[model samples]
Target chain A: MSIHRKNVLGAVFLAILGLLPLFLNSYWVDVLNSIGIYAILGLSLNLIVGHSGLFNLGHAAFYAVGAYTAAILNTHFHIPVLWLLPLCALTAGLFALVIARPIIHLRGDYLCIVTIGIGEIVRIALINNIFGITGGANGIFGISRPSILGLTLRTPTHFFYLILVFTLLTIFLFHLLEYSRFGRALNFLREDAVAAEGSGINTAHYKLAAFVLGAAWAGMVGNIYAAKMTIISPESFTFWESVLMFAIVILGGSGSIFGVLLGAALIVGLPELFREFASARMLVFGAAMVAMMIFRTQGILPPRPRSYDLFETVEGERKA
Target chain B: MSLLSIQRLTKNFGGLTAVNNVSFDVEQGSVVGLIGPNGAGKTTVFNLITGIYQPDQGAISFEQASLLRLPTHRIVSLGIARTFQTIRLFQNMSVLENVLAGCHCRMKSGILSSMFHFPRQQREERAAIDRALKALDFVGLRDQAENLSKNLSYGNQRLLEIARALGTEPRLLVLDEPAGGMNENETAQLVSLIERIRGMGITVLLIEHDMSLVMRVCEQIVVLEYGSKIAEGSPEEIQRNERVIAAYLGTEDG
Candidate 1:
């Protein structure tokens, strides 16, 4: 069957999921909500990791920025969680822009290191000086849930719908972005930065844009995460959490939107499905990632071009 | 004013000088070739002009604006674009998509408009797609627009690279080894294409090792050796210049 048909069927399958909360247990509903959050985070990382060819290991920094922004806004001012969603995303985007000038110049492992450092810094800061407001090691409690048009998301069922909507929106946005001009530019940059620049793409600007936008998407998810859990702490935005997001992108396929969602589901949902394997979870995850690198480094599904049959002859040339 | 002027442009790589004190003028709507032996810094000159490297001294002006300090994309926005010595089309993209990427800097849209698929962004995207198709057609690869750049034949890949460069609608297009790995027939086609590109009123600056191809198409030739200018003249004049002959053709008379 054609790729287009396959995509349509996938969409239809997802459309049927609007009623899943009716059948799923509350525990499973929580798993589903977590999957939604991770899917958005994974897809956001794909923009930089897959499309822009920039390795960002500290993506959780944006997640932290988002969480903290929402946490502080709601905890102190008693602001509505829904009102702070975009604000959180914008804050993370601005943070990305601030560091993008110097950071965008870094590549591969260096970029990874810097991002990792940024994540650590953000976490450390939250745990230290901001303790008065953030509650530091004690963490914040009584965090309010999101409400929409007088509807409060107090239960797993209610929040599942909101999370599901946001997750689908993130996927749709990423899908649109992957086919857009900016998406093409990021792909070009990923393939070859020099070539992309020569082609009249402002490589620095596009890289920065990708960084900022990716952070913003992750931030939106973080905002939802803050509301869902009704508590926040630096511990929630740890280095391992960032690594987990990276794992999702890499395990699924860095640039593929569906692959990201798939990765998120596997990483987030599998844990709940096999809670008996709790002690071996991290070990199994590590082994799977290593095996994937050894076997299918590109992930379960490599990112296919938006346009099919784009360059069959180039492959022929390589083979020749 | 001359369309492009480089006066005493110099670049140093640690202890080595890659581009040393070179100066030249490219008039508007002319095809100029930069030729040299291996490591002659021909590509280095291209790098300097395109903002890949900062010249230690001297100035580069395009349309009277100093391009020395401008970033690579900014230089491109100023109507200058280039291709690499190796074909560098976005390998996974369609020939049309690759060219469409080239057109990105020229198109205008707000972030919100692009994100929301606003009517304005859609119109610009449509225009860009049309322009991309036109560019591919110009390179005689319109039929291959849907083909992946990496899947194109070597010659077609080179042509796609040129087409992608042209997508920026540049007034000045720099080609690095346009006919680098092409067969004879492909080279002949490239010579004509070079002519056609010039006919489109775009000034061309090229670096090539293919002597016959360079001699046939380039109205002016600039020779560099060890990052320094050795000769600058018309192609006919360069063919006979003893220094060029010695530096390039070398001790072998043939």
Candidate 2:
């Protein structure tokens, strides 16, 4: 599409989105809020799985770490949930560091298997009440909602705006990262790790950085989720949640940020829209995912090869 | 003076000694050839030099610093770069991108500065792209800069590998089987390319099964048999060495 046409289309889409909360009921608003959350989640996962070609089936381990960190700090110490976003991210990033450090050497299916075990271990530990902090199966509740300018955000519309703003922030920062030198190195890592290392990129360092970055972003999302539900349990962060997030990255065309948002919309919003299907919703969804993969092996939007606009003819030497 | 020196280097994979007590010196601004019959461990020697396989015994020093136990990435930063036996281009990446990635060693942009597109980082990125273009131009693939690497033909793929290695700005360039499947015309082009690279003051070491290419471009040739150095001399000296002839004729053991 031409740049002008894309901009016009984007403007129209934003206009519809701006007017959506006005016409939709609170239930649908809540659904849209969830979609925004998953969109952020999908984008974070894309940094690792899509761009770096690391199979991370245990992403919810990091998410759970973030949610539980916020729940404990806010409910026990009363630190105000919003203030804990950075702390939540640090905890999850550290958790990923501790867990993924040794196993990062294992590539392909072995890495995937080890990560799966790590996620299960974290979830099971939370359920068993490790450190006497998780509140076991009942989970910690009564977490306070975030307040902005002395206004406590309580309703669905309030959270829709909260998630919307943060999601936009993620999009902007990740866009910068996508074009950055680090991002290009990650692409090289994904394509041929040995060659990347031969070219002087520390493969181990880059891979670990990708995992930590992705996990930190997921942890930030977890902070918002804890505040929204005001209660978080082990059930909220299951293996299935990790699978769904992975599915979103895959369905959206792995490395493309815009494609991830589209995937998140289809994955999160479609199920709610087809609530009329009742029990058949999941069956239909599974069938649709299978059919889509068959039709477009590269997802809805495969990543385009990156081109640096640095080919400008050096304009200084004219027949000197 | 030598740029890369190997003394009593050894590597063993289980019962087999892949590279057994192999030693050689690649002098500055010279093209050295490492040649043998198949399975003579020429590629293994390259792997050891690049730190892909750690040596079982002895030491490697490049530019007078001990390269023993330094990581592969660190070795590249020390002005040593190598291409693989089979073409190992970043297949999904564009031709320009492949060289840009090769220029990664010279780049000093950290994670934070790069993410923010700070002025220093932006300048480095531009310099890297220009250097990449220059490397592509060196191998005559500059016109295919934006094409995906996998779409290139066999000869182009080999040149692209050399270009990517050159983009590292190495003092020593190691190529494994640079003209493996090329016709005579392409091989002639490769001979001149190596000569051009030497003219640029970079030392070259290559492992080749093709004797004609090796005899043509190499100033010094090291012959190996079952991972041991059998002979090392000028091409004329190697051509008349009886053991070298026997090794090639497959009658050395008999």
DockQ of each: 0.42, 0.73
Expressed as tens digits, the lDDT of each residue in B1-254 for candidate 2 is 68899999899999999988988898999999999889999999999999998999978999889899999999998999898888888998899988887898889887778668898888778778878989998999989999999999898899999999999899999999999888888888999999999999999999998899999999999999999999999999999999999988857458
lDDT of 1 by residue, A39-81 (tens): 8899889988988988998899899888878888898899997
For A1-320, candidate 2 gives per-residue lDDT tens digits of 69799989978987888678899999999999999999999999999999999999999999999999999999999999999999999999998988889999888899999989988998899999999999998888999988988989999998988998898888888888877778988989998899999988899999999999899989989999999999999999999999999999999889988889999999999999999989999999999899989998678988887766745447433221
For candidate 2, the docking band is medium
TM-score of each: 0.93, 0.96
Name the runs in model 1 displaced over 4 angstroms: A1-12, A129-131, A308-320, B249-254
Give the number of the best model, judged by lDDT. Answer: 2
Best by DockQ: 2
RMSD of each: 4.7, 2.0
Interface RMSD of 1: 4.5
Q: Kindly report which residue pairs in candidate 2 clash with one another.
A: none
lDDT measured at residue B53 in model 1 versus the true structure, 0 to 100 = 90
